[model samples]
Target: MLYYAPDNASLCVRLALLALEIPFETALVDRSCNAQNGPAYTALNPNGLIPTLITPDGPIYETGAILLWAADQKPSHVFPAVGNPARAAGLAWLFWLSNTLHPTLRMTFYPTKYIDAGSAPLLLTATRANLLGHFAHLEAHADWLDDTQVSISHCYLAPMLRWSALYGTDQSWFDLGKFPRLLAFAKRFEVTHVADQARLAEGLGGTIFSAPTPPCPPEGSAT
Candidate 1:
């Protein structure tokens, strides 16, 4: 198998691959350099996104899809094979992170494209508020999104939280203190062999290195 990843989105998939102990060659696509937009990369994924995986079957994009496919390929602890409640729960959180949290963070950090220049500030403010609200919601539950002991959701969320700090989104937004379980969970995941290598490869500067807010709480909670 071959993987095309950038410095950002590909980290999770790369970690997943490493966690599964699968050996694959990496094609590093530099997004800042506009390599992903070139004709060659665009032919692989029309959307021109990072972390595209070329398996014997074909190419796959999107972090969630790549992780799930990797899980299915290995069918071990990272993802259980059949009739595992934890697997279903893990899948739920994975999808939630991909569909919900990831999009919100993307908008909050890069809102210039969606709104007029005059109203961009307002849009960003609202987006940040919405993200905080979500963080508060996640803070209320202490089970790490899914009720699993360990799963793909943690891998997906780790990078998001890392980037949140980079965007200076305010640590209090997610109430990190209240979600001790999640914090410990993240710390434990960080020390894993694969996580260490992935962090170095992705240039994360070694784990957020400080406590940040937990995942946002569910909506409509006291903040």
Candidate 2:
């Protein structure tokens, strides 16, 4: 089972699972009532995070770790094989996404978690500038970005782009169109079979990545 909350980081793992054709069950972690902090859910994930993928060996937490584990389970094109030369580059960008990009977005979305409310605007300004630089770096040099194939990196990144557009307090700073390559990517990715399934399951509206809106999910809330 994959424990998830609608529109949460779990959405990344969901996309990977669907693309890989992995059969798994989902148990919603109702964020509205703080269900993730409850005993039952915390038993599976000590961090009390949204996604906790139960496997026969054990349970897996962390979005990137879950995506890696899922890809390793079967032969899939999503991630390069261990011996492949591309594996090194792939692993680098994957960790960069997990370590650098994802946390930057987190800080942007929840600035108060890092500093006082009075200083959040300052933090957002800095992070938004940082985000523009990050996207520019990827837009120019991340050769791993494939317009035709959905990789594990794409699974991690596309939702982040959506959140960047939709979640922050003052979202006016972001403009997906500025990154033309990424803009085209969002246009293509949102139409894929895997993305379509996620949209329906989470009640995510059209152009989820390219032009996201406040989600109207059927189950748990996005927060």
Model 1: per-residue Cα lDDT at residue 218: 21
lDDT of 1 by residue, 1-223 (tens): 4444433667678878887887887776755467778998888888877768898779998889988998888786587666776667666767878998888887766677577778877887788788767666666752654344445667777767666655543434444445555566667777778777765564454544234323221211111
Q: Write the per-residue lDDT of candidate 2 for residues 1-223, one digit (tens) a residue.
A: 9999988999999999999999989999999999999999999998988889998889999899999998888755689888888888888999999999998989998899899999998998999999989999889988766548888899999999999899978889889999988988888899999999999999999999999988999888999
- Pick by lDDT: which candidate is best? 2
Clashing pairs in 2: none
True lDDT of residue 211, candidate 1: 46
List residue ranges in candidate 1 displaced over 4 A.
1-6, 145-150, 168-179, 209-223
Candidate 2 error regions (>4 Å): none
lDDT comparing candidate 1 with the true structure: 0.67
